[model samples]
Target: MLLEFVVEVPAEQVRSEVEKAYTVLQRTARVRGYRPGKAPRNILSHLYGGRVHADVAQRLVDATLNKALAEQSVQPLSQPAIAPAELRPDASFSYKARFEVRPEISGVKWEGFEVKRPSVKASDEMVDAEIAGLRRKHATLQSPDPERPAKVGDVATITFKLEIGGEFLDQKEQEVETELGSGHLFKEIDEALIGMNAGEHKDVRLTFPAQHQNPELRSKEGVFHVTLKDLRERIYPEVDDEFAKDCGEESLEALRASQRAKVEKELTQKASDAVAEQLVMEICKANPIPVPPSLVDQQAQLAERELLAAARRQGQRLDSNADLRARVRLDSEMKVRAGLLMAEIAKEKEVKVTEADIEKGYEELAEQSGKNVAKVKAEYRDPKKRELLIGMILEDKILDMIEAAAKITDAA
Candidate 1:
């Protein structure tokens, strides 16, 4: 998809452009011994020849690139990288224009492919697991009895004075809340708190890990004066009518029905997605072709940005390094290739988006966003966003046609 064009402008045009540049410059340029527009052409050329020639070169390309592309009937997808050159009087101005274009796909093999639909179903256990998750989400934290000691699965709040090699890490005692037996601080400390009661103090010795984030604490023997301040237990509500009401369901039976329906819908969508994936894989394997490097780069950038955004959401730092790009490069290439082939197939099928399709798309957007249809329409008024929606609709149309004809069999 990358093409380099060697364009040569005739000597006549070059001379004309150069003449225009000097004509404008001569009318405005200041000279040492002559009034403006009164200097000899040779004197002016001696002083400003390089500037005039460069301006002429840029103007010539700006004026003639469209004509050159029109002659070849080629449309570039990216901005052309014009090679460096200078204009010469009475000589052709030649330069290279390099850019990316859509690959000319000759043929496509996209029908009657054997694909598998995964045999996936939602089970009763899955629904129970989902309900259990809901209970955890709505769980409440409570203080344990004073007589009880800290144990596994109990959250312990404590203060510690840490010392390593006769130096204190914290100028004052640091308070931390961690789960007993979770190894959140250190395995030695988590184990030491297992049988300690509230208001109890204990001494623990540990070897700091070499890979610890702080260099001052790495690989050194440390002692902690630890006090168990308090203990907490996470309590989940029982799956009864009250819990159902709290979850916005009418009753316990209604909650189970709702969860079952959701689980079934998710399972069905997963199977359908698997079928689609198998179809695209088979089609790409059957008709392998080169993908445009620019498109792949664009996809990689989008993927990297999404990852960065996710890391930010999770309060983590991620660098867009060479390793990250290399990891996503192959997937980017495959995505570009698949998209191009599907577009080609859509063209072959003469699939087109109608006004009705656009309206339906708007309605679906409103439904998903819980917004009014008018606002949704207003949001897509930007031509770029509208075009993206049209493209998505076109892709869906093509995918529906291909999937209908695909030979789908359930996996064993």
Candidate 2:
């Protein structure tokens, strides 16, 4: 770590440098029965002696090195290792500091990168399919005679006492509710409960699978004294005009019309999202650059926090270290790649975030969040936080620019 720089000092200023050290000694020196600054300079020197001289020497070295680095425009990555000239209380001071620096990157090309946008359109058939899904959602269920063992598409009610290591695990009485499908229990006590019959109690022992979605119970074993209380099959109601009126529509035709409009809006949003994704992916693929490791780590941390927050919202905990690491690694790499590609696009196009654009973005966000636009704006009043949000908005704008330039083909 060697810092080479040209140093210049006026002959008159040399005395001033020594004088500064003397001033420090006068203010800081402690003498017996004498106030620090009020003491005579001669008595202060005699009492404190070379200790003050050493303190002054250290200060002079620091100031000289700082000035030298600033004058030479040298940026050090770490604190400089300085070696000062011999200490002199009444003379000019000079020194050199050695340190590493960041390398200046150059000669990188920033032109002719291209990206593609996917073309999409909502079709009548798609709208019809969505309407059918809505109909299914509103379908009614009637209990059927339970003769056969429970299967998929059949709902079953069971009274189960779950235990692990001979300890009763199902402390709640109303434990076994409707099993939408196989192994729908909050805690997968055992898969043995599946296909169990009504009014039959069985001591079912099973091991928790390694691939269990709940990380805490993975690879653990538990036993359940389960009683199949009732079993019933699902019976969907007919999708007729009667069902349509039940859904708050005057007629089936009106229901279809409303569903069609809703589907169309959703499809439009999906299409825009697809276009944005395609554009950024194409741009990233075409222009490959080394992403900063620090940037990637930061993005990964952000993704982890977001995922953890989502889990908390759903009353779930991420207990497995492996699962957490996998999520962090995947999310970090994707965000870093996207960020690097977006930065390249912004640099090439000279894209900027305007205040008006941020305001418009705020309006859109407020609409999505079901909040007042002014309130949303007020939430982002902090300048640094507002700038971060503006940066995200501008990144979306960059993707839009690339999408606008792309030649799209309808893939629907």
Candidate 3:
């Protein structure tokens, strides 16, 4: 429910606030003929009449709006939009405030839907890939033969100067080591780097992709002057008992077993998350409700903050991109809609997060963080944070219930 109404502060209340304001000015304002903090009310009002009346009117409007909202049982999602109006010393002040309220939802159908549950089984190839990734992380870098040209797997150490549209990119020569054909550099530059031996210098011209990370460089032609300094290749240790032991396993077979188990767990978790997201998507599609713009904006701001924090962690800048903000706002609206739909489903199903559920959540957080339950509880001392945790737990419970009641089918 959105409420739009006008309220007037009575003349007596206005006059009382004016007197209070005058009293404050009396102590703060200095008069030429009077001692400091001893100015009379009439003199103070005479000097600061308009300012006092404006301040008093603002205070009176805020107080009166609160009182009226309480009296009318109106719960606003955002701050009330008060219309601009003049405040006079002779009469009551009136203004209109418009705000939105939470909409009532009922009879949300969230269960008995058919959703494809992905069948995920860990394979030998997947386990091998995971193990290979682990090995790559522990691989040693060895200097390659200087006479040999750089290849796809070789890491080339280069000092490069970049120019876009004949303008130098940076003042200093930038040194970087990148694996050839890794897609980290522009395709043209990567290809040009390959077949270049040590002490080789080349000027490569290329156009940046339209979706380049830097908005200013996107779709722009650039020239890279690169000098190949050295070449290095990664050498992986042979997968044997020693490697297994290095990975904290007893033997090769034990390491393979552990890798397989880890792969299975990862696949299972991925499949579960996919199914849960699908369930929420279906529920939201089936039961469409109007989402308040204020809530959507709030969620968008939160999403923006989270995205900015993530970008900061990656040492990437995104604050200047309007496109990123628009994308975040769109994604946030979907998230807010899904959350509201889930809340309605929880309400309809009479599902609630119990104390035990919250305790279990705390235990899970503790286990993940390697902290004790007491420390976790202490960390979440804010009541609002605790309430948010409970809300998340309740949403999880609702998802579990829906998943249990859903008809599962294997995806093709």
Candidate 1's TM-score: 0.81
Clashing pairs in 1: none
| TM-score of each candidate structure, all chains considered together | 0.81, 0.66, 0.83
RMSD after CA superposition, every candidate? 4.3, 6.8, 3.7
**Candidate 2's TM-score:** 0.66
| Alpha-carbon shift of residue 41 in model 1 (angstroms) | 2.9
What shift in Å separates residue 263 of candidate 3 from its native position after superposition?
Answer: 1.5
Residues 1-412, candidate 1: write the lDDT tens digits. Answer: 7888888999999988888888899899999999989999999899999888888888889988999999988998888999956678889999899999998986788878888887566678998999999998899888875468778988889999988788787889899998777656788899899988899999899988775556877798999999999888889999899999999999999999999989878878899888777777777888789888888889998988999899889866577778888988877887778888889988887889999999999999998899999999999999999998998888778778888888888776
Top-lDDT candidate index: 1
lDDT of 2: 0.67
lDDT of 2 by residue, 128-182 (tens): 7866677667766656554776566566677777677777765874545665454
Comparing 2 with 3 on TM-score, the higher-scoring candidate is: 3
Candidate of highest TM-score: 3
Candidate 3 Cα deviation (angstroms), residue 344: 3.8
Off by over 4 Å in 3: 26-49, 84-91, 145-147, 162-172, 206-223, 311-327, 345-350, 367-375
Q: Looking at model 3, which ten-residue stretch has the lowest summed lDDT?
A: 315-324
Candidate 3 per-residue C-alpha lDDT over 78-119 given as tens digits, one digit per residue, 9 for 90 to 100 = 898887368776677788889988777777788788888776
